[model samples]
Target: MTAAPVKNLTLADFLHLPYVEESPAWEYVDGVLQQKPMPKTRHSMLQKRLLTAVDAATEDYTALPELRCTFGGRSTVPDVAVVVWERIPVNDLGEPEDHFTLAPDWTIEILSPDQKATRVIDNILHCLKHGCRLGWMLDPDDYAVFVFQSQRETEVFRGDRLLPMLEGIDLSLTAEQIFSWLQVKRR
Candidate 1:
């Protein structure tokens, strides 16, 4: 006996299918399912801290982790997706919508060691192409960050350098302070 050949599923059918527990993380890209690498300890530490920092830093917008946002035939789970309070999609009941059918105002991706840099960058670029105002690619390996405002504009920050975030976000964060979160003191 042989397994059935995988078919290109429509978005409706894809959503209806039961999620695979082993591969909890899934993304539909160009009609194909892609499994994402599991985040390691360092990645988790950074993600958690960054999420908290960004969430509190902005009164105009809020940041969240691993939020699945769908648009343009792709469902991207950005590490952190920030949306302005007014722009958040709401249903008839005046509550947050179950499905995010639009791009985030800001998309942040923290590059896992095993993940391809280009693949991560591609998601950021995708968000930008769809009206995202800012994108941040945090590289834990080098304690550096890549800020992308536009297709042709980018800047690298490291050490004590201040990281560029969305305009109107009142947080002042430096690469060094962010990288220091990885430091753990043990007996």
Candidate 2:
């Protein structure tokens, strides 16, 4: 759903809008307010499992789910946003800051059945353009992962092929292994 604004709303206007925690996330892209589709069962499951896996595999980085990051004149909520430990913003008290004013080091987007792939890819590209090290778009139905990095051709990994990871991240995951997380009982 696109919110109809009486006039073209600027990023400043979007930043001032009331944020409701329970509502579907609203993203500001290209001066348009776009509502992300509610996550479905597969999407939710994959997001949860992937987040858990990434978190467990890295000590130098943190993976947060549904984090809203603002940069390059856009606000986006990636399925999983990974930031290097030292790069995470902290308050005066040393606690993590509530708002991110920059792109994540690594952005992950899970493909929802109703979501447009182009929009998702656009956000990833935006992050890359803003100095993000890596991005991954996971397609559950296809059991594939589309990888993006700075100055590199996009690659699709499937089955047991190892998916790319940010530098210093020792964990290795395959598209099949990721999609297997959705199965409660493995064959």
Candidate 3:
């Protein structure tokens, strides 16, 4: 027995349809629709690491994982988002919904081989413009992290030193330490 074929649909059509368990992953860019790739192992590892670090630093605050958020009409699934606990809205059942309409306080994106740098940068900028306090783009190949803060210059970290962002939260891991974790063999 064979399964039924799925139809190729536009972003507009995809949005109008009810959310399903097996909805095709989609991203909208300037009114154009693009499919996102499934993350690879390296990408997954880095995302988990970053999430863990941020979660530890922001334990007192509410942090969401892989939540679909809409900003500037561009719905995206950021790897991780940190929201102040007080800002989260509770439904009638006193539970948070799966989707969030508000911008996150912080957004992080891990680069995949198939993803374009320019597109990722655009997303980061979009987040900044939408009141996101901070954004980070992690490049696996270069083992570098780019930090963005609204109305401030972007900072690039390539060595072993803590990347700044967290306030009142103490974290000591540096950029070099993060990249070193990607290595299978250390010199």
| Most TM-score-accurate candidate | 2
In candidate 1 the C-alpha lDDT for residue 25 amounts to: 65
Q: Write the per-residue lDDT of candidate 2 for residues 78-165, one digit (tens) a residue.
A: 9999999998889999998888989999999999878889999999999999989899999887888999999999999999998888
Deviation of model 2 at 51, angstroms: 1.1
Compared with the true structure, all predictions reach lDDT values of 0.81, 0.88, 0.72
| Total clashing pairs in model 2 | 0
Better TM-score candidate (1, 2) = 2
Per-prediction TM-score to the true structure, in the order listed: 0.88, 0.93, 0.82
Instruction: For residues 13-52, write the lDDT of model 1, one tens digit per residue.
Output: 6566686223436776666666677888998898899889
- Residue 170 error for model 3, in Å? 2.8
Write the candidate numbers in order of decreasing lDDT.
2, 1, 3
RMSD of 3: 5.1
Off by over 4 Å in 3: 1-14, 18-24, 184-187
Counting clashing residue pairs in each candidate, in order, gives 0, 0, 2
1 versus 3: better TM-score goes to: 1
